[model samples]
Target: MTTRDTVHELLRRIGESDPEGVAELFAEQSDWRFSWPDEGHPSVPWIRPRASRADVAEHFGALGAHHAPERNRTTVTRILVDGDDAVVLGTIAQTVKINDVSYTSPFALHLTVEGGLITRYHIYEDSLTVARALSGDTGPDRRVP
Candidate 1:
């Protein structure tokens, strides 16, 4: 599949909350990083580097496990594709299961597809807002409004 096709499929699978299906579009050995300086952040299950397709699957699985699919909302504002590189800009809203506090954070997900599979998956998002919500902080500023 083309890079754009692969990315669109990935988004479709993610919308369905199908973890394994999402991983199927990735290379066996992939470069994955979710938000740099991962430390000092609430240990949200999906907030770590993933090296393999299995790890990628696990990340999405953990996401589905921790947040209800009906409650977790991700809105894709734009998807820019250039050859094998695609950058998805969006906002994500989820309520942490443990604390039940909701948060909204704008995000940028960069993906590189080669050989019909995604080789790089990198994400940038507002960690502070997520961390605050995970800790049950209900401050008005936490929602990024």
Candidate 2:
């Protein structure tokens, strides 16, 4: 399959919340990276570096553990594909089950496909918003400027 096809399949698997299916589309030793400053941030279980396809499945599994799947929503607003790379711009909203606090933020996924499998997956999102929600910080001042 082509790079674009692989990315679309990944999106489909994510929409289905099929963690195992998602892992099957990734290369053996792929890069699943996230951009978040970990200093004061709450340890989001699914926000760690992932190297293997198994870790990819675990990431999704852990994500389901922390958030309410029924309340999770992702909308792809734009997509740009070039050769082996695809950039997906979208919005993701998820509610932390423990705190019942929800965070909705814009997200960008940078993905690279090679040999019919995904080799790179990097996501950029509002870390502070997610951190605050994860920590149960629902103060009036929690709104990010």
Candidate 3:
């Protein structure tokens, strides 16, 4: 499959809450980086940097532990692909299992595919909203009017 097709498939697997399916798309030593603070948000432990396919699986595991992936929805607004690189702009809506609070955040994901496997993955999202949701602090103060 082409890089674009592979990325689309990866998104499909993620939306299906299939971590193993997503892991299949990545290289054995892929680099995954989440553009969020490494400290102060212990509730969202998966926000830290991840290297290797195992780390990727652990990141997804942490996400499943904190949120209901079956109920999560990701709407890809745009996808730009060139050569082995692809950029996906999307919005993710998820419900925190702990407090049943929902949060929607815009996100940008950059992916690099090499030899039919994803080698680099970088994600940018609304970390504050995620942190609040995972921490069970869905107060009015967390929302911007």
- Where's the lowest-lDDT run of ten residues in candidate 1? 136-145
Q: lDDT of model 1 at residue 82? A: 95
lDDT of 1 by residue, 35-78 (tens): 75755455565677679999988988988777767787789999
lDDT of 3 by residue, 30-93 (tens): 8777767656478887777677787777777777788887777769999999999999998989
Candidate lDDT scores, in order, read: 0.83, 0.85, 0.83
Model 1 lDDT, residue 119, Cα: 96
TM per candidate comes to 0.89, 0.92, 0.92
Against the true structure, whose lDDT is highest? 2
Per-residue lDDT over 1-145 for candidate 2, one digit per residue giving the tens place of the 0 to 100 score: 9888888899899878899999999999997778785433545767866799999999988887888889877689988999999999999888889988878989999999989999999899988788878887768877632
RMSD of 1: 2.0
Off by over 4 Å in 2: 38-40
Candidate 2, number of clashes: 0
Model 1, residue 69: distance off in Å is 1.1
